[model samples]
Target: MIDQTPLLDQISVPADLRTLQPGQLRQVADELRAATIRAVSQTGGHLGAGLGVVELTTALHYVFNTPDDRLIWDVGHQCYPHKILTGRRDRINTLRQAGGLSGFTKRSESEYDPFGAAHSSTSISAGLGMAVARDLAGGNNHVIAVIGDGAMSAGMAYEAMNNAGAMNSRLTVILNDNDMSIAPPTGAMSAYLSRLLSSKSYLGLREIGKHIAERFPRQFERAVEKAEEFARGFVTGGTLFEEMGFYYVGPIDGHNMDHLLPVLKNVRDAKDAGPVLIHVVTQKGKGYEPAEASADKYHGVAKFDVVTGAQHKPKPNAPAYQNIFGEVLSKLAEKDDKIVAITAAMPSGTGVNLFEKAHPERTFDVGIAEQHAVTFAAGMATEGYRPFAAIYSTFLQRGYDQVVHDVAIQKLPVRFAIDRAGYVGADGSTHCGAFDLAYLCCLPGFVVMAPSDEAELAHMVATAAAIDDCPSAIRYPRGEGTGADLPEVPKVLEIGKGRILREGKTVAILSLGTRLQDALAAADDLAARGLSATVADARFAKPVDTDLIDRLARDHDLLITVEEGSVGGFATQVLDHMTKADLLQTVKLRTLYMPDRFLDQDKPERQVADAGLDAAGIVKTALDALGIESAPDETVSGKDRPARA
Candidate 1:
């Protein structure tokens, strides 16, 4: 309804954008910003980062011959505006929806994307690879990687930069410095200097200087180069990049098209310039007043009012699992001074911010470095301190090596609070936490637990704290708990144990994590069909309760194991134990887990239903296992009946 693309309507791709006059780009950037805000307000996604890069996106498309000239966005958080300008404006309203466009950049989505990204600090590496490939094929196309300052904290970015510098490939890296702390004053002087530094004439002069220096003694030649570099570095704050072997340019105003366009054109035309680093300073949430004022620049949002900027977040029926995790951890830390918290950049997302509020001295935000966070926590654990590394399950994948080498191998007592451990709806496959269970369960001497609800989460937090011998982890899902009452004081349960929720004889449903409710619902459905079902919650994936599993397998004619994870996870552990105990000979066993494919963005419930982790799907599996004939209408719940192939 609020489509405000007048000038924007004429341009469908980057080629069309190049047709526009230079002066008209400011108007296009403004319109693009408005369009991005309007679209994100309706769809509820990353707003601020996209807003910051509007002018940069417009300038790049206008100056560079994109699609032919490859451009990559690091982390892809600011790609919404880029998406709109590159033939995706028509489908902008359908962002992050089922069968619609993904929230992040995907190589399969459009030609303009060049490289796909969601996780941070990978753009330079990808761009360098493209640059080398292009050089190998005798191609002259330019490659540019746009990375944010926050993402620069990751070691991978430095590693890529170091490698790119050594390789001396012709690549361009734009460091978008949105942070106020590091950015220099961007005005006429800064713009003129950036433009001059990146110009072809300056590059030619530098090359001439190199040739002249080569004719002299090696010591004097090195001195000449240092003097030139330091003189430029004195004027512009680019000494670090220059030392790293890149021709540094900028501290230019990223929002100023006059400044951006000329500098970008200069960089594009400069021949034989190997790995140039252009430092462009911009504002996060630049155009939008509300986002500018808000902390995190309205980074991630729910669907909202276009006028008021009031986010339309659903009123929660129960406390969010994240809040519960944070609150309980904070409370635990109050009693235990040695209990410390560490999060790799995501403090609020992983509930470590709450821990920081209570115990600021003990909480550490390692900043976009998952590897460092794990190893740092392991170091703390060595000093007899209880360290809880609260990281998202998807992010924890980045630190698996540290988890195995630093913690598991050393047998450190570091507790891992893995948030978002299952299907994270709108974030799609990239952010889905489907493999933490599988990955952690396989690690020797690791205790992996998943909670059924908030109360169990609190208990598991305590359980993990109590375990001081080996590394432990508690995996929990996103969104709110199932309205389960919180305990006044959390209890530490016995490890390698499970609780039977219901008593029955026909079918035994063994559940791990949040699927316990679905298992209960399935039991009710089986009861309606004149079949009794027993439901048990196996909280721990590793050190699984073989006693409970064997009892269920032997007692029931059909045994079913359900978990909200990938293959080789909780269900695999249960199956392995059952097979080893020789319980599989008497009973018909069926395992239900996430299917072997990446699920696209959709409602969480729809994702679960499609994965056959819902109540109806469980009941259907049970009926199929027992060889019972039933029509679709006769299934457990009409609303939840699985779509048959």
Candidate 2:
């Protein structure tokens, strides 16, 4: 029944971990690996990373006094082991399922989690803050931050390191150099690590010098620190972090607890004050054969067979929505020289892979730095290049300030192909593209669109690319699009006009994005109860179709706006516009939007069902609000509903 094996279950807390002998640590690692495999097999989550970090997790928890010494994991993709040891083992079976544990690190989940993270490059800054706070509070606990090398490329990590070095804060950063983040990491930082680790003779000599320096007494120790800094700068061709201020350690074996424990113990006990970074190397998918063989496939997966590691995928003949976006962008770039694509180190995830391949010179991946990605796109637009800033809606939240300041304020024509723009399953609240519509819709002069199907998604992408306005965004969800045949390539949808899906009416439901299916289903069910309701896809969220919205309000007895995202999103924008136009008084208004709570994990449809954003629930809400309630023979828990497959 267990996937990897109980190398983890017998023990519960840090005290149990501390008691394990060095030889037993391997068993613990095995158990952690097995536990993670089993949990993710059932719950469907980011499995490959946790398996990769088993040894590192064991070493950190065993060697360091957790719940006393603080640990912050960047992005938290590699925290499953950390979670298991920190009294979360019992909850592991329910990982990422509805009413289950979150996939990312969450402070509310446990005391040891320290800081919650899903976004990258936040570990260093968060750890620095905790270390500084510990100092001010007179706490002697050591603060450790584990960040992947991919995250190291972000400027904020450097900012924290720079500030921490100057302040001489007691902190340690663990660089988990897997050399990959879904894909091989890019940028100067990744290249430097490769070069540094490649030259063994150079590294060996540097270590020998440090070893000899440790034997020196009193003033000699201070001299050694000074000499080491100069020698490092000279030998390493330039140390980005050490120069900024950090006691540099490693490029060590992250999976070898033998080396990790001693190094971690030394760093924890060392009287040497200020920031220290230990660069530990580990394979992304360490133990499992399939995962190690194809790390990206296992990076984030759905439920799979334990024996073969074969995922149970829904049969979709059509390509994923993101794939459609990428392919179209590639075709566009092939024809147009000015058309370029950019992603925040998420080339594949955001559907810009085609653009990257067809126009590699024009495509830029800024390495998990969304703020830089947005502003960089804005800068590119100024140079007479049309840059499609493709990014996931959740990640784009990081660039809100830049969007308002650098792009919107300057009126740059940066086309945002906002992928994964609605409820994201398995990865939970941290990954859900909940606030994008609300945030983008409110931005002055910004045009936002949510497509109903693959056809509209293609059209919207073309429309966004063609817009020379301040900024335009077309948000689409994850997974395969509805089986609708796509509209002709480069076909244009009227900028702010929405087409009505149905034309009946006691109630008119204005649907946004893929939730149009839910609206349609609800309308069908409502008709069964002798209630006819119109369904329309309100394609554009911002600069909303006032003429259509007002017409619906005047014609229908009830005007309902349904969206997958939280309330106050596109639906709220509709309300704001309707109120401004004095149209709210025209009809009884009802909005079917997700509740203003961080949604828990479940299948996407399940979460939507629980949140009352699905077909049956939508009908129920609409019927109730319409004061014409009809009792359905049966009802379903969004969770209880059979999955799409």
Candidate 3:
């Protein structure tokens, strides 16, 4: 059992932490680790990443002048320990709750958080920009970007490194090499080189050269530099970083405060040093027993018992959308030998792990490189293979260029299984899959789809697998299905088609995705008010079922379109079709979608209600369109309906 931390209680911010001796920092790290675990146990969140970085977080804050000297965290999953030290210790229990602290870093939340980050591999680019801005402004503050080894796989990080090298910007990049991204890292040579460079003998030789160079004459200085460079290249094996114009430092033990403090101090005090890369080897879920035992399982967990490590995940009646996709794909791949699956370091999160288990040789994990994953899938498609690139909707934004240029432009049949289609609850704005519909539909010859439920998702998966002429994408929301009965053999859905569930005369509701359930409920409420409502499920967003839309437009007085996406998505497509077909003159239209602005962290249900996509909200919108005010105490059907006053 962990006890209350007296040292942690006394230190509220980095300033208070700086007063402590280097020897005392270890205790502080322990306390912070315990605190983070305890806090996350109360409110479920990213536990393992933060636990791994406790010592590093403590040392960085203690050694550096933060809030002045900028410290940016890549991916922000490991920012929990940093948050505790940076004046948010008291409110740590409120992590990821509605109106509470965000799961990731936010610029508006605190001055210490110079750049907000949740997506992987963006820190290097953002930090380099900050460093360049500081140089332009004649500022002397140090800019440090702490990035994960997983993040290094993305092209964006390399692009930033190349730019920083050319610019000769004074920047410090701490590569936290935990040997794991979301899943186990793909590359082996980098890890081998890091381990070799971080060896005791190599670091000792580098330290000896630094001391010798201080006493040498001006003429011997160049010779000493050449010797040091050759020694680093020979023993340390960091030629890649050196070639990129960065002075490479140790693969140091990240958990050791003695090692971290002095190295950080040296880097901060270096007068003319250009960008430096410090490879620090650390472990994910370092101190916590349960987390260390199963790193991936504990990466993002529900509320758990701190003592027992038993997670409190609510039992769901239906399978998750991810599992359904994986199962259907695996079943299809058994029949077709040409089927292959790809993921960008998220095998389990995307449910590609299931497919990997079934067909280990066919499954490819392309690390955290989404752009590569897309192009690689396109290459497989050219060879007459069906490649399913299963990536999160938010992360797919990073590979949009490749999606258009490599797949859409070439007319490759790469099936994009877009997971997390709309508002993600605890992960907040940075991870929300709000713009995929708008972004994907705009591409020429791309077949875009969204599933209304689990069964539809299975059909869409089969539909995407069969399409061989062009790029196809099917988006589904995060979480379990609505307990709908799934078919043993998934049926292939027809392209550009919609199905009507209920028929009515006065109002027509067309829902594109998971919002069909809400539309059905709204129809019931509308019927209570003596208004007949028709509900239709629009399976495809790109080539919207023109026949169904035209029929609805002609038959109904008011036509309402709802989707769990932002503007310029499904509703926009429907409106564009209606406008071109001259159907707008007959029917009054209302579109319900996510607001233009980004929403902060909140429950998915609350977000939908607030965005006016819920039953009550839909009823209000329908009633307002007809210029009818709801009676306060009206009986709608058999239920007591609270009317909009």
Query: Number of the top candidate by TM-score?
Result: 1
TM-score of 2: 0.88
> At residue 339, what lDDT does model 3 achieve?
95
Clashes of each: 0, 2, 0
- 132: Cα error in model 2, Å: 1.8
lDDT pick, better of 1 and 3: 1
RMSD of 2: 7.2
Candidate 1's C-alpha runs over 4 A off are: 1-4, 631-645
lDDT, candidate 2, residue 105?
A: 89
lDDT of 1: 0.91
Model 2 alpha-carbon miss at residue 248, Å: 0.6
lDDT of candidate 1 over 1-645, digit per residue (tens): 235767888999989999989999988998999899999988999999999999999999998898899999999978999999999999999999998999999999999989989999999999999999999999999999999999999999999999999999999999999974365855798889899988888889989999999999999899999899889989988888887888899899999988999999999888889999999898999988889998989999999887888999989999888889889989998899889999999999988888888889999999999999999999999999999999999999999999999999999999999999999999999999999999999999999999999999999999998999999999999999999999999999999999999998888999999999999999988888877889999998989999998888777788898998999998888878877888778788999999999888999999999989999999999988877877333434322433322
Clashes of 3: 0
Which TM-score value belongs to model 1?
Answer: 0.97
Model 3 scores a TM of 0.92
Q: Write the per-residue lDDT of candidate 2 for residues 1-645, one digit (tens) a residue.
A: 344454565688988888868889977887787877877878777887788788999998888888898989899988888888888888888887777788888888888888999989999899889888988998888999998878988878888888989989889888888875222333345434434533444456666777887888868877876776776655443366777887666556777666676667767766543687776778877888888788384888888888898888878877899988888878777777989899988888887777777788988988879999999999999998889999998999889899999999988999998888788887788889888888887788999899889888888878887888679998889888888897656687787899897887577999989999989998888877766788999899987888889889877777888887776688878888888988866777888877788876778988888878889888878778756556545542223334322
Q: 217-285 in candidate 3: lDDT tens per residue?
A: 866876877776787766555568887888787667788776777778777777457798987778888
